[model samples]
Target: MIRLHHCHETRSMRSLWLLNELDLEFELQIHPFDKSLRSPEYLSLNPAGRVPALEIEGDVVFESGAITELLCERHSPDRLGRNPQDPDRPDWLTWVHFAETVSQHSAALTQQHIALYDDAMRSPIVMKLEAARLGKCFEAIEGRLSTPVENRDYLLTSGFSAADISVGQAVYMARHFVRLEAFPELAKWYDRITERPSFAASLPPEGAELLYKRDFYEVWNG
Candidate 1:
């Protein structure tokens, strides 16, 4: 049996979207995004108390990148994941993990804007800095999508894959802090990939408590 511990709008959504794409039969256990993740039971699965803790085939995978690799290795070594032998493997791995680079900035911005409740606790400097970093990430994706290729639809020349899902979900979170209007290529690619049914399935169900209450967070000057 496969089970995924998820929290709405968290990085876990990446796994959820991939699972949906893979058409895998898995149970999803939704958790609130809060200190409750530090509970002993949750910690037993992922010592880091993260949102995504997958239980599969009597083994557990904690990290989102690891889970993406393991799931693709076991289930989709060709389609969603490029095996080591595949020519696109290097670019695939590079783009897949690059999602975290985008996510780290979003996480910091989230903390500065959402996590810290008090105005005194929030850092305008940090928010602006991280948001700028997210824009840089967007620029990288724009450059990739604009690369000289027959059809620059997805991140890889090989076409759609988990790499898009990985970076796509990270963008989903990062978008709350950084607007996409400046990066036309990135915006177009994001719109294209997220149109998949799998992406829609991973969205928070109606009435679910959303991690991001606002569609965009305006960063104030320090």
Candidate 2:
């Protein structure tokens, strides 16, 4: 049996979305995005005490990227994964892992804007810097999408794959902090991928608590 421990709107959302896209049968365990993750019982599944500790049969998988890679390999290698011999393998890996590059900044901004809570505890400098970094990340994606190619609707020239799911979910979180107005290509690409029904299925259920309460966050006012 495959089981995924998830928190609404966290990195785990990527894994959940991929699972939905692959039409996999799995149990979803929703956890409160709080200290309870550090509890010994939870830690047994994922020593890092992070969301997205996936259990498959007797094996366990941690880290969002690893989970994405493993799931695609096991279930959708031809469709969502570019295998070692495929021409797009390198590009696929680069873009898939780039999701975390975008996520690191969002994680920091989340800490500054929400986790810290106190005005004094938040750093406007860190907020501004991270937000700027996210813009740079967006620029990278914009440049990629702008590359001359026919029917370039997805990251990989081949077609939509797990790479899109990984980076798309990261963009979903990053969008809470950065507006897409400046990057027209990136904005269009994001809208296109998210239109898929699997993306809709990954959304936090009604009345579920969310990690990001705001649609947008400016640098800390204090």
Candidate 3:
């Protein structure tokens, strides 16, 4: 069975969501971010000491995007993995990579500079720079969603795919760094993604204590 080592309120949620979308049964190993990640035993599982590590057939895989790809390849090949004979295979692969490349930067920057900084009060200039950078990244996503889609409601060629799962989580995180109302198109997309049964089902129970307690404003208001 696939085993997921997860921490609440992190990109690990993406892995959980992917498994749910794939309709695969797996064991969930809940671990506290502050403790388990640094423990000697856990370090043996992942040198980076990050949450959302996957153990499959005795092999460990870390990184949320990679984990999602692995699950799709193993259990939901028809939905996410490519068919070599399909002409759209290249586009599908591009969509998968684009999610992390374009959407993850802003959220990562905000978390590192504003949310997690040790001396946030002492670095007003850096904070402003980070905010500006985040804004620019959000604008890029807005432009993409606003572009005319041929027929699909998602970022991919047809139906939802791993690209939506990856990029959707990034956009969800973006709420921490920018106001969703400011980006109408992206906000629309966010609402649509959240409404999906797969996405909603992946969320942890409400009020469940999270590993990193973030302010509500950071989560919804951005």
The TM-score between candidate 2 and the true structure equals 0.98
Candidate 3, residues 1-222, lDDT tens digits: the string is 789888766777778778877877789998865755888888888888877789988889987767866777777666766665666567667766665654455545555544564653334555456566667767877776777867646665666677778777766665665677888887887888889787887776798775334532232122
Rank by lDDT (best first): 2, 1, 3
lDDT-wise, the better of 1 and 3 is 1
Q: Each candidate: RMSD to true structure?
A: 0.8, 0.7, 3.5
Q: Cα lDDT for residue 141, model 2?
A: 97
Report how far off residue 20 is in candidate 2 (Å). 0.3
Off by over 4 Å in 3: 102-122, 211-222
TM-score of 1: 0.98
Show where candidate 2 strays beyond 4 Å. none
Model 1, residue 73: distance off in Å is 0.8
- Which residue pairs show backbone clashes in model 3? 175-222
